[model samples]
Target: MNTPQSMMLGWGSLVVAAGVSFYYAKKTINERRAVQESMGQRPSEKLDCASFLLFLHCL
Candidate 1:
């Protein structure tokens, strides 16, 4: 069973992971927006729910 210290560590890791993911997502969105603006085109949406589900099943 996990002790209090272990639980705290796990929560800390989760917080760190969430922060990193948020930062990366924001950076990617900004870069993609800049590229789209320069190219005079909207960023393409290549996949929808059905394709995403298919991809999960493939894995």
Candidate 2:
């Protein structure tokens, strides 16, 4: 029952949201890495491993 224009609008909004999420995630990861490097630590490790474990347990 949907028109082509409606479908295009939905897809366009999805693409824009995905693009914004990618940009913010990339920026945040870069900043975290910079902070870790400055502290002489590995940038690849989780910053809250215990919290993650607790969250998983709750889930």
Clashing pairs in 1: none
Report the C-alpha lDDT of model 1 over 1-59, residue by residue, as the tens digit: 99999999999999999999999999999999889978979745668899999999999
Candidate lDDT (C-alpha), each: 0.93, 0.91
> In candidate 2, which residue ranges exceed 4 Å CA deviation?
43-59
Task: Write the residue-wise lDDT of candidate 2 on 1-59 in tens digits.
Answer: 88999999999999999999999999999999899888989656665988888989999
Q: Ten consecutive residues with minimal summed lDDT in candidate 2?
A: 42-51
Clash totals, every prediction:
0, 0
Number of the top-ranking candidate, with TM-score as the measure: 2
